[model samples]
Target: LVTIVAVNQTGGDIPLSQLYAPNSKIPASGSANLTDYNRVEEILGDTSDLGRGATLEYHPDPNLLVAKTKDAPSATLDCSVGVVAGGTSDIPIAEEARIIAAESGLDVVRAYDVGVAGLHRLFPPLKEMILRDVDLLIVVAGMEGALPSVVKGLIDVPVIGVPTSVGYGYRGGESALIAMLNSCVPGLLVTNIDNGFGAAAAAYAICSRMMKKREE
Candidate 1:
């Protein structure tokens, strides 16, 4: 019969021979032996796993971590960015946000085509994100730009409003800009019209600060 000895170590498993005498004896079956056991115990006495520094060091893949670290600010904790768009036409702006966030080493999730006109589409993905606890939210919309206001009302997290120039007719893009500027929700922030990169950068700043605070 083979006996197993369990030792907790990080980075990978370490053989018993690495830590103990190689000439150690094995007990025979049915023998009430304490002689060999005592010797082993004495060698490892008073040394718990913690005391022995037996911990698994999680080293993220060098290539993956390096790529992310190259872009991210020198911070330890992970930050997340959530981007939402009002309609299909607004996707380009939302894509801009995603690209910027990704370049900055922030994990990004996208919720698209959830404009206020289709309220139901908004909540399912939005609710999922809220439950997942995103670090920041970017709301992109045009043609009245009411989506951000609605989002601000629904969630307490910081929302950066991006007014896309997707509208036409006499209202022009002015309607979107005015709607966002006049939003009733307190603490709702607005960026330049169609400036997805700016919105993403702002969100990255907020999330990076949060990560730094957590480390402190």
Candidate 2:
């Protein structure tokens, strides 16, 4: 299994043990670090994944870790991922997903500034993705987060919605998250706010399964 680490903003172990009781959500995201040998060791003695055949990789951005097994997906696999950014501000997150998916051996293509305000701009790149037969679409959008649902309506493939912290008002990206969660589209999947990493990881899993089916 590949493991991804979400580093603490300040760069150290998250205070999960200290804050877990008060904030239930923190544990869900932070507790996974328990397997990180350098940080936590009590739970798993040989927590160093290298010995267990797990490899480690880091994101170009400092706050995240990625697992890239270059040989996992064969070069011949037909699966690819399409990434779309609803606006310029969303590109960094989209890039994160693209980099992770590419490193994990999935062919990745992109479309940018295709927000719903300019619906016409979305079609060309989308057409390219469809022509390439992309296995999944990672749509990163903010401000109402309608792009994912819109793209899902247009394409038959599954969509992964990444809500970024780009809007105003109550809690960070919660509005977008709510909008995505409320989508009527059946195959649209929603990741957490600013979680491009999660979206990529999910895309990798799907592509890996596709590759496996092809081999069989």
Candidate 3:
């Protein structure tokens, strides 16, 4: 028999001692006692089939804890650290963020091409960096300039948006900059278009503040 189960590891134990199926939407806090085991298989259908063993994928749930790797980094840090994530337009932003961070003597984690177009691609790496306890997140996106806003909504850390000139025509970069400036997400920051270095500088400043706060 092939069975799939979802366990919440955020709180150190699964609430109500229950496991959810992949299709289940786990609430932040709740109790669901699924009585029919066959229903899960029906939902998964032939998708769970593997050559000889079952494959399990971990999908994040806002309400429940997703299992983290054993060797995951703790949320405490020794120095200023940040993560630079890019989407769609990947040429210079991620690289520039790393360079700026390094020059400023800060640790930087880079995740490339995690734009909203392939939305799910960004979460895992983002989560990993969060686990590593980064002090800030810099999201570089061109075209629509939406990735930063999306990331800010999911994470509590400060997000600096770097809009690049990856689109065609003069209007392309301007439009992206406008979109970033007009982002409705509260406390979101927008740097000048194609300004990865500026974003990293802001991140370093934030890290400096964090260090000061920790010392206080």
Candidate 4:
């Protein structure tokens, strides 16, 4: 919720949206372009409110831009975050969010390879996650972006949806983003395309508030 950075896709027909796309020996590198720099400049243009929103970082090898939100939560409450990936291709972003949640001192429980391709696969691990009683669940998906809504319907915990750039002709998460945005499930939280960090940040903020209320 702090900063916004805009960047354009490089390809014409099948864009190299994600570095880990199928048959995508496409992206040569993850270099930041002028537009990226300019976007950063625009976000950092005014330092009116400092250290409140987010911090931006770039991954060089695969060339990803990530913004992580940080804040320390209470040590007393045994806070935990559950992260689920719709498919194997979405693991990197899921792991990134999990790492951030762990760094913020929340125990992270993860289940992978449970995408909506097979509905039967999601239940066992999902039951385990719910049994653990996590403070929040961060669901990462691409394609039709149906995982988050499914998770939300099954659980009462806060659900954060991350739409990755994994679908065909979805334009690097466009379809997934739209799916998440249009989700009829009430109270389902969502992040931008491939934005795992934002989900983690939102998770941290929510968990912290809950912990504070518990203390109060």
Q: Tens digit of lDDT per residue, candidate 4, span 37-118?
A: 2244443463233233434555432233443333312222357899999998888788767755654556899998898899
In candidate 4, which residue pairs clash? 30-63, 86-115
Instruction: Using TM-score, rank the candidates from best to worst.
Output: 2, 4, 1, 3
What lDDT is reached at residue 17 by model 3?
A: 26
* lDDT to native, each model: 0.62, 0.68, 0.58, 0.66
By lDDT, rank the candidates, best first.
2, 4, 1, 3
Which 10-residue window of candidate 4 scores lowest in summed lDDT?
26-35
Q: Estimate each model's TM-score.
A: 0.64, 0.68, 0.60, 0.66
User: Given candidate 4, what's the lDDT at residue 144?
Assistant: 89
Mark the regions of model 3 whose C-alpha exceeds 4 Å error after superposition. 1-77, 169-172
CA lDDT of 171 in candidate 2? Answer: 74
CA displacement after TM-score superposition, residue 136 of candidate 2 (Å): 0.9
lDDT of 2 by residue, 1-216 (tens): 123332232222222122112111212222222112232222123324423233344343323333222232222236789999999888878887886566555689999999998999999999999999988999999988899999999999999999988756147788889999999999999999988877977886677677778779
Better of 1 and 2 by TM-score: 2
Query: In candidate 3, which residue pairs clash?
Result: 28-63
